[model samples]
Target: MNSEPANRRIVRAPRGTTLTARSWQTEAPLRMLMNNLDPEVAERPEDLVVYGGRGRAARNWEAFDRIVATLTDMSDAETLLVQSGKPVGVLATHPDAPRVLIANSNLVGKWATQEVFDALERQGLMMFGQMTAGSWTYIGSQGIIGGTFETFVEAGRQHYGGDLSGRWLLTGGLGGMGGAQPLAGVMAGCSVLAVEMRPAAIARRIESGYLDREAADLDEALRLIDEAKASGTAISVGLLGNAAEVYEEILARGDLPDLVTDQTAAHDPLQGYVPAGWTIDEWESRRERDPAGVIAAAKVSMARQVRAMLAFKARGVPVFDYGNNIRQMARDAGVEEAFDFPGFIAAYVRPQFCRGRTQFRWIALSGEAEDIRVSSEALKGVVSDPTFTRWIEMASERIRFQGLPSRSYWMGLADRVAAGLALNRMVAEGVVSAPIVVTRDHISSGSVASPNRESEGMLDGSDPVADWPMLNAMSACSSGATWVSLHHGGGTGIGFSQHAGFACVADGSDAAAAKIARVLGNDSSVAVFRHADAGYPEAVETARAEGLRRPYAEALRG
Candidate 1:
């Protein structure tokens, strides 16, 4: 801690039409980068840690300041080039080119291990990007709430034959991405028991209206879970304990849950997961002083947790990996049966990906809730998806704004374009107070190529192909995205994944409208094409119906 950066201070995004940059195109990324580190959003902003352990917005405070300064004075015709969170160069380009182009955490295959990454990081050469964090699109924990809720609802349809009312979901971890699980479970009409090692995380979720109850002991947490299930009520209970320890204890008790999954940060064992029987302080200290020991201890603990998950799977529980790379960690620790269960993406989210639907979000730069409301209401006009409408309504009522007021639309490309255009028109007409930034999670259908997560099990067994995301970044750049980022080793950790991110501002200009239509359509078009190329029939059908011109696909159809 003594060696960390000295710039430990509060940071917030500028609100209400303040022009810190030359234009909204430049200002959008600046505001989002600041928002990512907001005390209300970032998991540990003091150390530059945003979400996943050390998934920073910039390499250091110096890099952060430089990035902000670059964006502030940048011309619309110049594009800033960032490498692993450092602003490397600003080159002359056309106005339609991406204002910022970033490449983070990209290591050659031979040197992509966590050990090498840790060494380079200690020398201040690189930083982990972790999906949305480095790309500056994170919307706090609730950013993932809608996706998690839909996953639970889909799980209900698959196993329990449609409602999850009296059922209970047993899962672990409540940090960052996992923090959404508890509330998502309740919103899906189920009771949930989530085990987390941090007391502060539990309290934070409760304060954010994402968790309903908190317990310091396992027995008390179980009591709460039981009472909710018995009354057929939907509620979420966050229990303070190490996931590995609590999981083994639960396995000993032999009471099965309706669903099972995990979100512990097992991907970066040295800094992510907490080892069983270790105090949080010990874990933190050992992470810096004895990284090898921390990794070894976390891996051993992860094996224990995986064995318990396997037991639940053998007992017919709807168990799966929630994409934290826990199974991979356990496999490295000699747990061969660890991967008998499927990943959540392979089992649940792939069909949606095939249809070009994922997590799309828009943030009101004014930080006004009414601005978000006006935009979300515009979405209801484009499509009558009851699920979409219900989520929007519930989120409006229940979710609290973190840093910037935002709304998520889990919809297809056409609806996304229509909604975005409507918002742009509203901005022009003064229906909304300021510019809105439209973006999507890096885990979208066409954006990521992580075999352990997004592309877990492709139809053509092309899970390891990295071309899709590379093509995605190029497509977004060609389509005039405000910022286009290509990242390596984000979602599942070093050496395991690659992804892309794109976000553009809707500033109510003709240029902004052109970029939104092209980029948004390009986003879904590339997704359908990728899945169709992978031999998914749903993807093929969607491609044909959407009039996407793939010569081979059209030839095959004829």
Candidate 2:
């Protein structure tokens, strides 16, 4: 019996790079552990290289080193490339073949494991692993090719200039996808400008001591760029935000000098911003729907636009987009969905909430049942009577007929009802006990008011009011109970909310609660119900009155 852990398959490492025997197996075993991955062997075993020790830590480091060495070697290629993680390999292709570069962090292989690598490699292009030493590793017919940090810095220096006097602009600094691209340019001898809406985000940059204290927001960033341009500096501008809106706005401004944006779409919005040329760093290409639908949709749209814009690149216009290649590869492979939302959510959410005493159950409800149950005379006695029929009709119309800009705003409601009913059925069938039903209730007075005013008050709160019982119901509900709830106004009610029956913690209670509270105050209206105060039924009555009866009945049925 070989008696070795399956993780021990020889993976290719860069030539001239040191490696341990055990590192060779990491890719193989890691692939096996993942559900969708298949282990890919090197085309030629002799071309395969290994690094690191058999022991876990050494194996991990060696794997990283291999990626770094490969990327460093590839950066020497002719094409201007931007990569995620580390730029490991630059393709040296025939004149007819488009130049390709793989830029990613070495951590991609180590953490994403072999499954991701196999999936990426199956695209039939050269694969490179980004190295931690600020380099890249190219995996190919000849084996691992390497590059180094000095090379990347030199490339960046050559591209941006040595004095760091180039004009640079950045946006979306307030959100996760937003950050200091201009700062990178500044480090590369470009004058840095950043635009961010979130005060806290701006504060964070200031606190980090990264950006020039004077540059904040789009206008300020542009002013800095203009100032740098007057000083005879090379200019690079970056736009950041949600792809659609930010790009649209940047194009509308019409003032950008040498504009560059992280827009996934290739066609630069000609209305406001025109670029001398753009470069794209294809960050996320294949994303699964379900959990990651929103992000995937955005990326897909960006990729499509980028493909369309590639032609402009040949017109002597520099446009950066990564869609043409990825889309073609994806289409060839017939992969309908590439990104995994469930996997992402599970990876991100499960550890934080699942393991603790805090527990959550997915409850789905039938829209019809919810309407009938909440409107029943039995429940209406204590709870305010709502116009259930009207609300349902409106929701249905919005989903089916209205061309609302935000489909999620409408379809999500129906999804919530359906999911709640499904959950109710689960409870009724004993698949789960004490499941909580979540739904959306309307509290806004303008055109979308529920008939039950007081119930809405208790649930939605016209202004800022704290209902201890409602908070208790939510905490109790989160533990082990089927509670009826909805998405929108629940931000004001229970600490639980839903997007098409997919449950999420209330917005106020999201990971940044403390920071938000610090801004909103300890006694802010947005405070979510705490677990310590779990004992309220008044809110339950309000819920019951508002078509939450099916979930309540299902919960009580047991």
Candidate 3:
């Protein structure tokens, strides 16, 4: 923790129609950066950690202050450049240029390992940005709750005959993304046992309303789970224990959970995943004292955790890797069958994602729930997908907006574009209180290359190629995104993945309208084309049905 006076506490953003910057474009990033650090949104605001292990909003307090200062005075025609959460430069550009361009945790292929990253971070040169954390679009665990709920619902449909009542889910970690699991499981009508090592993590989840209770020990946790299961009450319990140890103990017991998964920060072992035998304080200190040794221990611990999950899978229990790349870490640690279970995306989300739908979100600029309500009502009118409509309704009733009032769901190409256009019209007509900023995870078509997660089992075996995300970023930039980011080592560990992010603000102007139309259309079209090129029939059908203009689609049409 930086003890500097400017860096020691939770930072809150100015709310309600006040622009500290020259324009909303600049203010958007500024407020979002601060919002990400808000006590309600961030897991550890004092250290700038928003989620995942050390995934941070800025490299350090100095960098965070600099980025804020730069955004404050930056002209509307200027673009700010951020590298690994540090403000690097400002360039004069056109109105269409992205207001912010960011590259986080990006390393050259030869040196793209956690060891190198840790060394750089120790020297104040880099930081891990974990998915939405560094991109400045994280809207708290609610941002992740809907997707997790969908996954659980799908799991129920596949295995439990579309019913998860009276069941229990076993998982690990309570980081930013993982914290949503408990609430999602409850929403799916299942009891959840989420094992987290840190008391702070458990407290945060409880405070955020995602967790219902904390167990005193493994025995107490099991008792709570059994009680919940017996009563068929949907609830979430946080167990304070080491994941590896808890998993091994669970394996020792005969009965297996209905579903099993993990979200421990196994991707970056040295700093992300805590070793089993060490205390949290010890783990944190030893990481600095002996990073290589810490990595070795953590990898072994992860291998143990994976082996336990494998045991549950062998018992015919539903198990999946929650896109944390822990299996790869275990594999590296000599667990030959570490990947016996499939990734969550591969098992549940890929089919929908093939049609250019993944985790999508929109934030109301005014930070008012009523603004969100108006946008929601307008979105309901435009989107015809009954699934998405129900999702919006469920989310509105359940999810508590942590920072800026926001709504998120999974919608394919056509519905996404329609929703964007509808929100734009509402903004233009003053039906919505303020402009809406739309965002998506870095998992879109041509936006990510992660063999273990997003691109797992890709039809064309193009999972490891990095060109797609670069193209995705460029396409978003050309298509009028307000800001675009290209990042490495998100979801998966360093050297294993590259992804891009897009954010477009609907400001009620004609330019905003045109941008939303083009960006949303082109952004989704690229995914359709990517999937079609890979020989997915549904992607092909969607492309033909929507009359998308892409080389592959045009060629097929001819």
* lDDT leader: 1
lDDT per residue as tens, model 3, 1-558: 224585457687777777888888888888888989988898778889988777898988889989988999998789999999999999999898899999999999999987787779889999888878999988998887877888899999999999999999999999888899998999888999999988998998888788999999878888988888788687899999899999899889775789999988788787678889889999988977888899999999999999999999999999999999999999999999998999988898877766877666888878888998877877777887787777777777767889888888878777887788788888889887767888886756558889999889988887787877888889889987988888889888788899999899888888987888888878777787777778889888878888876774566659
The best candidate in terms of TM-score: 1
Q: lDDT-based ranking, best first?
A: 1, 3, 2
What TM-score would every model get versus the actual structure?
A: 0.98, 0.26, 0.96
Q: Model 2, which residues run further than 4 Å from truth?
A: 1-166, 169-180, 192-203, 213-217, 231-240, 259-289, 304-558
Error of 1 at 103 (Å): 0.7
Clashes of 3: 0
Model 2 TM-score relative to the real fold: 0.26
- The lDDT for every candidate, in the order shown, is 0.88, 0.26, 0.85
Lowest summed lDDT across 10 adjacent residues in model 3 is found at: 1-10
Query: Candidate 1 on 308-338: residue-level lDDT in tens?
Result: 8998888899898988999999999999988
RMSD of each: 2.0, 25.7, 2.1
Model 1 residue runs over 4 Å out of place are 1-7, 556-558
**Best first by TM-score, ranked:** 1, 3, 2
